[model samples]
Every structure is written in structure tokens, then in C-alpha cells.
Target: MKKKYKERSARFRFWRNIAMFLPGVIVAFLIGFVGSDHPIEFQKLFDRDMLYIGSIILYLIIFGIASTYLFSSRQSYQMMEATEDEDEAYRYESQTRRIYDLATIFKGVMIVPYLLVIFFSCQKLIYEEKLTGILGKYTIPLTFLGLLLLTFGLEHQFRKTFKQIYGKAIPRNSSGAEVRELIMSMMDEAEKQICYEENFDIVFKLSNYVLPISLMAIFLVGITFQTDILLALVVVSLIYVYILVSQYKITKRYYKE
Candidate 1:
């Protein structure tokens, strides 16, 4: 049990460490999409390159610390669930609650940057006559809001389920262990079926690689060939559909497995 917990905990920490910095990458990408002309003075104070690099670094630092605490709490919880040790369970619960509070403090780190993007988009549309930017601006906020609500709803459901199964009491009738085992069993099945590498074939690989390259090629072609806007859009749409179909096939195979 100890050996298993150590292995699992180590893997969890390593992956969670990687995940901790992912918000920085997403923030950078979103900011790239929200590119706008800055005032000369503002640009002089902090150029576009500096802005992106600084924001990415700040996000990484904040999110990395928060994720470390959250992951630690999670690891401790997982350990508590596996063993029947009362002292260990108490220690884990105490540590979890303390660090969980710390993690929540930095929860807005990702959201704030995204909100800034929407704000900038709106500013551009209103003052700069950027009608085309309206779609991306509104879409980002609406989509982000929907995803936030969905995440909260799913988390609430998981918490409710956990409380119902395990309750507040520690080591109650060994239910924690039983629940852990059940979770592990489900994970094993999922890793075999959904995560199976065989589901991805040559076509999938080629499509994944070629999709971006094709899009870039099409952009170049559109510029050089000077194709009609509608025709270029049609070609892009076709490529998008092909990529979407490829993803659907992978998903279909997962379900079949």
C-alpha cells in the first residue's frame, strides 16, 4: 500500500507540476489573440514583447504556487483514502484544509487576464471601429462564463457525491478505501479504453500535423494566389470539418472500446 501510494503520489505531483504552469501558456495564447495597437507612450513603457513575457512569467509564478498547494492537499487526501491509519488521516485532513485555503486565494489569476482581454476587445470595438473583433470579444467572455459555471457544477456534484459516500467521519466502515478502490477501477478501465494509443492511426497523425500546416499554407496561398474571400473560407471550412471528423472518429473508437 505504501509503495503504491508513493508511486501514484509521485506521478500525480509531476503531472500536476506541469499542469500548474499551463494557465500561463493559455493566458499567453489568449493575449496573442487579443492583439491591439497600444498608445505610443504606453508602448514605450512596456513593449508588446515585454507585456507578453511579463504576464506569462507572473501567471506561472502565481499559478505554480497555488497548484503546488492544491496538488499537495490532493496527494495527502489520496494517501488518507488508501490507508486505515487514524493519525495519518488526521494529518492529511489538517494539511489539506490549510493549503486548500491558500490555493483559493490565487484562483482569480487566470480569470483576471481573460477578463482584461474582453475589456480590451470591447474598447477596440467601441473606439477603434473594429467591428470584426466583436465576435471574438463577446464569444470569449460568454464561452468563459459557460465553462466556469460548468466547472463549478461538476465540482459541486463531485463534492456532493464524495460527502454522501465517505461522509465527514474518518475511516467510517472502511468506506473511504472502498470508494478509492472504485475510483481506481474506473480509472483503469478508462485508461485502457479511452486513453488507448491504438485509437490514433496514420490518418489521425497526419491530420493532426497537417491541419495547422495546411491552414498556414492556405493563408499563404490566399495572399499569393489572391483567391476570393468566399473560396478561401470554403477551403478553411473543409479543413476544419476534416479535423473535426478525425476527432469524432477517435471518440467513437473510445466509446466502442
Candidate 2:
């Protein structure tokens, strides 16, 4: 019993450390760049053609993250269901699985905005060659959307994953060192599955979140860069309305069912 308890404690601490550290790592590494003031050699951007190339890089990063989340969620759920379970484990898995499914749907819905951004990013560089001249016009909102999905989606999934695995591993009636070891093995499998699900959901959610904002930026560029500001605004507004409505519809479907 003591050995089992120690092993479980060690495992929890490790995963807990990971759960806490990964987000901090992202914040520290990515956000830290903002304070660097070595004077960006604008000449580098010009010479390297980063403007065009950067778009591709951004898109690829977004796609990678989003796909990872989607794949992870489903894979984790399958892995979890493969293991032993109590009533709590089964219930927890069901809830977590559902959330993963919803995240997948949200990921798919994000495409509407992503394609728009690509279209507009291209429009500004290749088609129109005009700049928005404001990072807020595109980047701010994109960042917000990504953060929103990442924060809420990951937390929700993590809670579910932890609850299911932990709950299943230490049932009140179970006994014996060998039995405990078996439970430990099952817990390990469950943990892997949950982690995968969480990551997969994040990819799609993050991608979707940024996709809309990028499109919005593209629309804004049309207004800021060219002659048809009024028309661009109208088109942009309509697209915005469309996205909101789509989300509302999606929400209704899942919220009720």
C-alpha cells in the first residue's frame, strides 16, 4: 500500500508539474520577445522578404497546433476507454470525451476564418500590396482568440482527464499490492490518453481562434490599403456577423444535447 501510494504521488507530481509548466513556458518564451529592444533591423524584414514568407510560417504553425489538439483528444479518449474502470471512471471519461468532440467541432468551424485570412493576407501582399499599418487591426484580435481557446479549452479538458484517471485508480474497495500495481498501470495508460486528447483539442481550437482574426485583418487591410473603405467595411461586417451566427448555431446544438 505504501509503495503504491508513493508511486501514485510521484506520478501525480510529474504530470502536475507538466500541466503547470507548459503554459508558463509558452508565456515566457513567446511573450518575452516583446521586451527585446535591440532595434529590429527593418532592413532584415525587407531583404529577407519576411512579410510574404512570414504569412506561410504563421499558417503552418497554426495548422500544426490545431491538428495536434484534434488528434490528441480523440486518441486519448480511445486509449482511456481501453483500460479498466469504475463507475466514476466511465462517467468522467464520457464527459471528457464529449468535450473533446465539441472541441473538434469548434476546430472545424474555425476554418471559415482561416481561409479568409489566407485569402486576405495574400490579397494584401500579392493582389493589393497595401498594409493595415496597425498590428491591432489583425494581430491583437488573433492573439486574443488563440488565448481564449487555449486557456478555456485546455483547462476544461485537463480537469476532465485528471478527474477520470485519478478517480479510477484509487477506488475505495480495491486492495492488495499487486492489485494496486495493476491499478497504477491502468492509470498510466489513462493519463497518456488524456494528455493526447487535450493536445489535439488545443490544435483545432487555437487554429480556429486565429483563423477568424486573420480574415478580419485581411478585410481591414482592404479598407486601410485601398480606395473602397466603405465597401470593405460592409463586407467585413457581414462576415463578422456570419461567424457569430455560426458559433451560436454550434453552441445551441451542443449546449442542449
Top-TM-score candidate index: 1
Misplaced by over 4 Å in model 1 are 1-68, 108-111, 131-257
**For every model shown, what is its TM-score relative to the native structure?**
0.33, 0.31
lDDT of 2 at 115: 57
Writing each residue's lDDT as its tens digit, candidate 2 over 57-151 gives 55445555555655566566666677677775576566555555555555555554455445545545554444454573465346446645654
Instruction: Flag clash pairs in model 1.
Output: none
Best by lDDT: 1
